[model samples]
Target: MRILFFLAFFISITCHGNLIWSKTGHRVTGHIAEKHLTRKAKRAINDLLDGHSLAFASTFADEIKADRSFSKYSAWHYVNYPMDIRYEDSEKSKYGDVVMGIETCKHIISDKNSSREDKVFHLKMLIHLVGDLHQPMHAGKGDDRGGNDIQLQWFDEGTNLHRVWDSNLINSYGMTYYELGDELEESVDKKKKLEIQAGSLYDWVHESHQKAVEVYASVEVGEKLRYQYGYKYNKLLFEQLQKGGFRLAKVLNEIFS
Candidate 1:
């Protein structure tokens, strides 16, 4: 009961209020792209996919089957643990949840007994979780299911804190997934390439979690945001989405290679 109370209270604080929008869904999708490989990575991917044509969900299912530990959780489960804090106030904050996620992925991947498919599952999960870890809200601390409990009026409809960020923000762009991906692909180059490095999953999550902190800090209590803000942030959102996809692809390619 004590733990339940604490969890409930925390949930209210983080989510039941005004906090809205997160990058979880887009990041998850992006991670899907990140883990899909090309060329030599094919064999590893084949073992991972069990002979599927390499679509996103198929790869995800393969990874899940490989890693039994993950069965305790789900594809959308939150990452565990936190990392270094640059700000004292943020020390108690949830900004580094992504770091935890990356580490979790690493742990599963490195286990010798882990099946090829499970390694693939962990890898795919890591890719998606890394994307979630980056979303400022997923790194949320103080409960609120990362602010899912927060209620708000998004575009004149009543919504919760989590839903707005999970899908609504991207939906506002009015672009299909393919269209968004293509537009972002056009912007990619050597510079963007340097932004996402090939490293431990924990490192990637920490990077995003840190950014999540910055995002929450920028908003105010009860501030009603509209189109201008969305437009300004759209590019950033797309970039994250694209980065996740490309990085996912790169990571999977490496493992299979």
Candidate 2:
């Protein structure tokens, strides 16, 4: 039992270091996107992934962090820009960002000259980066390293603004990805679904950047966030997840169908 406890503690500490839309959150995005995939997109994806579900494959980008060779991909997960300027107007990162990542993935996957292995690799990355793109903190200010530097407490436990937005509330809510996804997916009316799926990649990135501005204002350094913070932002969180799903489906459909 002591050995098991040690393993769990080690894992908890290791996982807390990630700056991502937690594994379950990514799975939730993948699940919702699965429900709305076009038949052609589904068929194409089945071929590419060898019958794997998007939920099963969505964590590829984050999972690769464990490997030293994947270091180049680190910057592809998030982007930084000032709140007041448009992304086009802002200075860009030399290492690449979510928008560039999405474009590269699409180009590779859609390239008939590309190899099967390359398509599979980039398709998984595309799914994950799309999910990442919606986690407002991933589109955060450069100075804060996308909220990873803003230290704070999450209900008396030590955490940062980035981790809080990444996994704190969703994990504390304690539902499996499938369970939360079913609940959020059912809440969508047809018209709302259409609206969510209507935006372009450029448009979606800016939308998330705008949300990042608000998320940054939600708390301050050394502040303790608890139930009230959850109550206030949970709705916004759900909205972003829903948008990520619908938009992912839209992106995939445009590519494969």
Candidate 3:
């Protein structure tokens, strides 16, 4: 009983959502998804977003964080599970998690009985959450609050492990979302695209968790990460953004097509 109580207490405190990718990372996924979307999916998105690009609509979920009424979504940005445990074998967050958020968005958007307003809202959230799912830090273990507590410095500026992965590396690379997305498109030929799009959402979560393990190993608490860290991780960074884009396209295509 004591162990069960302790576990429950730990989850209640640790599973609060962490910030996801920076605006640029989200936009890269959105841009790549746009290129790969089917004609019907594009039309549906156009109607829902009033012709805005997916990149334009990709950050709605984060933008609403300032509003108190949107507080229910605070826990929907990340999941809590043990590092070595597969997500299916771990305890689930009672408040909700990214998987639940994605499923909710899908249901609302797909239901013929759903209100147009509800569809629009959920679709926008879905776009952001899909990209959120790819940011491996968001999939990090809950004990450290998705690495937000792992304080460090980026080029001597104070930051945390989560922020470094969320924005610092991508920001330091200094490419616009368009440039990054274009490069990814050129690099991903048909076979690679197929492989990227092949996984189920569950598989993607497991994949991110694996990456998170490496991420947690990359630095000690209070470590100062500099140019060398960025150099080493840039490929992983780009791969994640690219994977996110491909998977998001697959999801939107399935939903709308």
Candidate 4:
């Protein structure tokens, strides 16, 4: 029993440390995009997904991590840039970064001769990558492995800077993705939505990289983060998720329209 308990604890710690946005955050992005998608995009997406909603489809990229064959895609979730360099000026990963992954997925889905199976796979990837792109840590500098190495405490529990932004703050609110999606939708008006959706993909990526710099400056290693931390950063969290959703809709609208 003692050995079993220690192994279980070890696995839990290992898994928790690497997770990206809590499932809730990704689903919220998907749900929000669903609301903003044009009629043509909606129909095309439904047909490609066999009627799966964007919220459900949003998780496919993460879920595939369980299969070793998909291991090559692990790097697709984030892009790293040094503080002094723009992504355009930085060295890109040969295995593919978030930006490349998103672009490739778009190209695949937009090709008329692509197989249905290929289109479905890339569409799911597109949804998930867009959400990942908005996660500030996903734009982290390579030195810290996107803040994964910046260990910290979350309400005194062992965690890290990457996990905190990925899920800790959003999960602390105790809202399901659907609930959060509704709340976000209510909070933003059309003008704000348009503003958030503005900018090219590179512009959006640079925005996230800037936010990542702020996130790194907000705390130090071993800091205990709790209510006060959430209070300070929750608004930024919502804005990123909202922007991700809106921008995803814009991308899909352009592709399927």
lDDT of 3 by residue, 1-257 (tens): 99986675566434432386888999999999999999999999899999999999998888777555787987778886888987888788888899889999998899999999999999999989988888888888788988999999898799899989989999999999999999997899999999998868889889999999999999999989999999999999999999989988999999997
Cα-lDDT of candidate 2 = 0.90
Clashes of each: 15, 0, 0, 0
Q: Roughly what TM-score does model 3 have, to 2 decimal places?
A: 0.92
Q: Each model's C-alpha lDDT?
A: 0.53, 0.90, 0.88, 0.90
True-structure RMSD, every candidate = 7.6, 3.3, 7.6, 3.2
Model 4, 104-213: lDDT tens digits are 99999999999999999999999999999999999998889999899999996988889899989999989999999989977889999889988899999999999999
**Pairs of residues clashing in candidate 4:** none
Q: Assess the local accuracy of residue 17 in candidate 2 as a C-alpha lDDT between 0 and 100.
A: 52
Q: How accurate locally is residue 111 in candidate 1, as Cα lDDT from 0 to 100? A: 72
Compute each candidate's TM-score over C-alphas: 0.66, 0.93, 0.92, 0.94
Model 2 Cα shift for residue 256 (angstroms): 0.5
Q: Which ten residues in a row have the lowest lDDT in candidate 1?
A: 15-24
Q: Sort by TM-score, best first: what order? A: 4, 2, 3, 1
Candidate 3's displacement at residue 17, Å, is 11
Of candidate 4, the 10-residue stretch with the lowest lDDT total is 11-20
Off by over 4 Å in 2: 1-16
Clashing pairs in 3: none
